[model samples]
Target: MTNLLLALIYLAFISLGLPDSLLGSAWPEIYPGFGVPVSYAGIISMIISLGTITSSLLSDRIISRLGTGKVTAISGLLTALAILGFALAPNFWVLCACAIPYGLGAGSVDVALNNYVALHFKSTHMNWLHCSWGIGATIGPYVMGIALSGGGSWQSGYWYVSCIQLSITAILFLSLPLWRRQEPEDYGANTEESPGSDASSAHPRPLKLSQVVWIKGVKEVMTCFFCYSVMEQTTGVWGGTYLKLFKGMDAAAAAAFAGMLFLGVTLGRAASGFLSIRYSDQQLIRLGMILTAGGVLLLLMPGPAIVTVCGLMTIGLGCSPMYPAMIHATPQIFGREHSRAIIGVQMASFNVGMFVMPPLFGLIAQHLSVGFLPVYLALSLGIFALMQRRLASLYV
Candidate 1:
């Protein structure tokens, strides 16, 4: 039963990731079809980020009321519907509207599941479950590529993924019994509390954001979170555009290559799960920081197209362990009572980064060239390193 429940959660995480890469992969075709400026992708991305922000901040209350089972199921259904809306839309405005529910669903499911799994599952399960997310993320671009190939419609891509989403939603709805069967455990243990637990009220009642912001080390950690998110989301959202416009790939090829980062991520997290047995969370994070720098340097160099593609994969590989390790470390950094709330705030900071930077880069791509992406990523990575340094100092 435990293994079955964990498998279900992994599936849920996969659902969380399926739609994430679609727009970025399809955007070159989408923008041309919709007759919008290339920068308009930012508008849609920003709207999605805004919705995620709202839902992420409100996740605790919603999860408290709905339980993890219902919240996951309902959010899955919402995302499925939103993806279908994207498939059927006639105008860019409808795409923009569809972005709303997708964002809201994605954010709440992310927060709820991450927190739930962190407490109930093994430490390594958290890492591997995220790998499951990478799997879905990797598949998205391939699906879009298939849809765009042979003169097929991008709508078909979203349509297929929406069908997958509906399937996952049904599984989640069926697993409500599993979620209900687990009891809440004492989340305060230094180790994962127990296998049989749910995330309901996992943290003590959340503190106000004003208060959470003032906790020792919170500022630095939040800065790290924000910078990390900016790099990751910006890359996911704009990586294909960079490939298409600057690297001379056609829409189909660029869309397919966009999955390279996610593929690297999927592999990296799988490796990290095993590495965690021998290394501390901070140790894994530090290694990631170094790798990310090397990856960014690779991007900045004048190179063959393959070199640039390799650079994207390297960046994705470097990023894999950082997020889950950071979340796993929260209870130790702050008290367990405060960890859940602080993690929520961290995610909010992450959402804020997602909200602002992608569109900001859209303006950059609009006025300047997407050629500036490497430099932009380099700067973001440098800032992330600095904050992680500060966070480490305060951590011990």
Candidate 2:
């Protein structure tokens, strides 16, 4: 029963990832089809991010009423329908409308799933949990790449993903019975071998953000979350278009190559799952920082197409472990009692970065050179590394 339940959670995580990379992969084609400039993708994305922020804010009330099972099941359906709308929409305005529900669905499910995992899994499971998301992220663009490459429309690519999301939603509905842990505050109700499943906050109070700000390492960690999210989200949303505009690749090839970043994420997290057994989260995080920095430098260097592909993948590898490691270490850094509140604060920072920075970059792309993206990535990554070190100086 437990293994089956874990499998269900893993599937939910995968569904969480499927929609995330679609826009970046499809945008090269979508903008022209809508008779809009490439920078307009950020507008749709900002709308989606706003919806996600709204959902995250309201999730406690909604999830308390519906329970995690129902929230996940319904959010699954909502995201599926929203993606289908993306497939069927006639114009950019309709796509903007669809982003609302898609963002809401994604935000709610993300909150529910991560809360459940923190309450019922180990760090290694957390690593693999995100790895499952990596798999879906990788597949989404690959599916989009295939659709575009095969002389099919981007709509066809969305259609394929919508079908997959719908199938997952059905399974999520079917597996609702196994979530006996959902109704209770039994944060310790995980498998016996994995002791100390967290009592993370599902119902948080209005945080006195000013108070936690004084905690020695708090600001640095939050800064890390902010920078890291900006890097990952910006790359996922803009990387393919960067390839097309600068490298002169066709939309199809750029879409496929874009998946390599996520492919590296998927593969890196798979390895992180094993590495977690022997290494502390801080150590793993440091190692990831090195890899990510190296990857960004590779992007800066002029190279052949393969080097560009490998650079993206290397950045992905660097990204893969840091998020899960940071998340998994929350209890240790702040203590389990304070962990939830701080994590909530950290996520708020993450939300702000995701919502603002990517679109800011779009403005830059519109006003300046899209070719500056690699330089931008390198700068963001350097800041991220500095924050990690500062965080370590205080806590790790």
Candidate 3:
């Protein structure tokens, strides 16, 4: 039962990742199809991010009310519907409208699942579950590439992935009993505080948002989340555009290579899972920051096409373990009882970064140069490193 639940969690993570990269991969075609400027992609992203932010703020409350299993199943269904709307939308406004549900669904599942894994599973499972997400992120673009290359509309790609999400939704619906039947021991500890573990009985009262953010080290953690999110989303959303416009790759080839970024993340987290056995989460996060900075430096260099691609891959690899490592530390850094609320706020902070930074960077790229990406990324990584170090100091 434990293994089955873990498998289901892993599948949920994959479903979470599937839509994340789809817009980035398909944006080149999408913007043109809508007759909008490239920078306008940020508007749609912002809308989605806004929805996610709102949902993330409410995650703890919603999960407490509905339980993680129901929230997961329902959010998956909602996201599938939104993506299906994306598939059928005839105009950009409709596409943007669909983003509301897309973002809302994504936020609930992200907070619920991250909190679930952090509580019920080992650090290794958290790392590997995220690796599953990286795999899904990788697959989203490939589907888009195939659709575009085969002369099919980008809608086909959305339709295809939405079907996969719907399938996961069904699995979640069927697995409700598994979530309910698990004992406290089946969770990581004897306390039996899994996200779905009868929250009303266990927690009687959930933490308020104000209370969660007021905890010591919370600000630093949120700051780190913000910076890391900026770095991660900026790279995913803009890497393909950078490759095509500046690096001289064609659209299809650029999208394919952009997929490599998530591939690197997938592989990197797979490796990090083993490393977690020996290294602390803080150590891994700092190491990832170093790799991220180094990768951005490589991107700053004028070199062979392989150098740029390698740099992007390096950035993805660096980003891979950082998020999960930070999240896995939440239960320990705060307390197990506070994990769900803290994780929800952390996710909200993350979406705030995603909401503001990507579009801002797009505007910068629009007015200045796309080449500023590495500089922007490097700066954000450096700040994230500093924030993480500060967070560590609070513990020490």
Candidate 4:
């Protein structure tokens, strides 16, 4: 039963990850078809994230009323439908309309699964569970690249991904009983009395940022995550277009390069759990920020295709461990229950960064040069690293 439940959870994550990978890779090809400017693509990307932000705010309450299994099922269906919408969308407006449900479904699954894993699974499982997202993300671009290389349309790639999601949705429905039948002890009072009890108590009560320990550390973490998210999404959302416009890469070649970025992220995240076990979270985070900054610097260099790919990969590696480390470290300082609330607020910050920076970068690219965008990424990451000490102390 445990194994089945874990598998279902992994499927849920895969569903969440596939769209980002596919859309990011295929954006250059699809964007022009909709007859919109490149800058509008960034705004369209935010629509999905905006929906996610709204869903994250309501996830706790929704989960409590509907139960995790039901919510997962509903999200799965919504995602499956949204993928189909993306495939069939006729215009920019239709694509933007599809983003609404896509974001809601993705956000709900993300928060619900994270909360469920933290509450019920061990630390090792938490690490593995997140790695599942990397797996799906990696697959998303790879699949899209193959389809486009075969002379398939962008819509065809989405159709293929939608089928993968539907398959996972079937497995989740089959395994619903295992997830729903939680042991009484799992939710009993004894678990609440544990050292991290205060964290849980923070949840049912209204949110107060003051209740969080390590206010300085929280700020640092937030800044780091915010900067990283903006940089990551900016690249993911715009990299394909840049490749097409500046590098003169064809759709298939561009998608392949984009896949390489996600592949780098996958390899990085897959190893994060093992690395965190060996190093302190603070050390790991510091290293990640440094690597991310270094990667951005590499991107700024005038170089060959190998150098460019290497730079993007380095960026992916730098980003891979930060999210999990931030999440896992939170409970060590804030307690388990409060972790969700803290993360929710943190995610809000992340969304705000994602919402603001991509379009801004797009505008900059339009007015100036694509090469200049990496400088902004470097600056954001450098600031994040400089402030890591303050974030670390928040836990202390």
Best lDDT among the predictions, by candidate number: 3
Q: What are the models' TM-scores?
A: 0.85, 0.81, 0.88, 0.81
Q: Global CA lDDT of candidate 1, please? A: 0.81
Model 4, global lDDT: 0.71
lDDT of 3 at 259: 58
lDDT of each: 0.81, 0.79, 0.84, 0.71
Number of the top candidate by TM-score? Answer: 3
lDDT of 1 by residue, 251-277 (tens): 988877876776777888999999987
Answer with 1 or 3, whichever has the higher lDDT: 3
Expressed as tens digits, the lDDT of each residue in 154-272 for candidate 4 is 99999999898888788777766776675222333234312233323433543454554344356666777688777677777667666666666687777568655656677777777
Model 2, residue 68: C-alpha shift (Å): 2.6
How much is 35 displaced in model 3, in angstroms? 5.4
Predict model 3's lDDT versus the native. 0.84
TM-score, candidate number 2: 0.81
Please, what are the lDDT tens digits per residue for candidate 2 over residues 193-228? 333545464344434557666777888888988888
lDDT of 4 at 323: 70
Residue 244, candidate 4: Cα error in Å is: 8.5
TM-score, prediction 3 = 0.88
